[model samples]
Target: MPQPPADAPALAADYFQGYSVVGLLAALGVLFVAVAFGAGRLLRPVAPTPEKLMTYECGVDPVGEGWAHTQVRYYVYAFLYVIFAVDSIFLFPWATVFAAPGYGATTLVEMFVFLGFLTVGLLYAYKKGVLEWT
Candidate 1:
């Protein structure tokens, strides 16, 4: 069997050289990040007073421990907002596809199915009194 051509070895060497270059750049990036973090640590002043350590709420002194009981209604409202927001997000893409040919009927049917699921979720929330504010 004939030995591989000289250009073949040259190409392999070039590939390995490219790998080393990438490795070197990655190492340099990590080194620079570490040096920056170390410089910030060394140059930055360390100042921690009681006032700074205390929890601040709208510039008012915290009266009690940080832990406090929160109403569950707020969470429910947030979840409902998220559900509707995502539904709206889906509408934009669906609108784009709805304008395209060959996707109208199928997309419309699928969208109704998706809306049905959303309606079911909303109905469940309503029956559970999650929609009520008081």
Candidate 2:
């Protein structure tokens, strides 16, 4: 193995110093959370009541079963919403890149390809009646 230069020790020390700062910050964050939780526990009242002990759900008492069946259509709707939301996010970056010289045609074609995939998925969902409210 080749011997490192005299400056190598200084470089290594500086590299480790950066990591030491990060470690110190992480330690301080943990200590702060610990102190806050400890203070809350020591200062808070310990009175227990039936109302406080019972499980609460959206200001209403939990009914018969903890597990409730949800329709699969709700999940499908959420998935479709996420797909279009992400597509809209991609459009911002695509539009910026498309405005740059020499990238107009390339970006346009790529965006169309992306939109085509989204269109296909939407069409498939429509054909399956996933878009129907009935």
Candidate 3:
């Protein structure tokens, strides 16, 4: 291996200078946020009325319970959507890589394995009647 130049210390300082600049900028950002929050807290009025303290929902008065039961089917649908969305994302990159030389057979097999897993999950969901709308 080639020996580093005699000016290695200078190079190290130059590298650290970049980090120091970044650190300074980060500190400035935090300081700015702190100053803004402090100014807002100091300048804002402290008067608290019943209406102001209560939760406001548009212009309409509050209705029944705030918490409502959400159906598990909605969550299942969302999970399936996310799975397919991620599958599409992976597909695009895999297509590009699959077209590259020498990666054809390997990527093809790997992709089949991936699709197999998805298919198994889909079949499992179907068996569980999760796909039923009723």
Instruction: Indicate the worst ten consecutive residues by lDDT in candidate 2.
Output: 61-70
Q: Taking the tens digit of each residue's C-alpha lDDT, what string does model 1 give over 44-134?
A: 9999999988888998999978899999899989989998998999999999999999999999999999999999999999999988877
Over 54-101, each residue of candidate 2 has an lDDT whose tens digit, in order, gives 888999988898888989999999999998998899999998999999
Per-residue CA lDDT of model 3 for 1-134, tens digit only, reads 99999999999999999999999999999999999999999999999999887778898777887788989999999999999999999999999999999999999999999999999999999999999998
TM-score of each: 0.69, 0.81, 0.75
Local distance difference test values of all predictions, in order: 0.95, 0.95, 0.96
Model 1 TM-score is 0.69
Worst 10 residues of 3 by lDDT: 53-62
Q: Of the candidates shown, which would achieve the greatest TM-score relative to the real structure?
A: 2
For candidate 3, the TM-score is 0.75
In model 3, which residue pairs have backbone atoms overlapping below 3 Å?
Answer: none
Question: Model 1, poorest ten-residue lDDT window?
Answer: 59-68
RMSD of each: 4.8, 2.2, 3.1
Enumerate clash totals for all models, in the order shown: 0, 0, 0
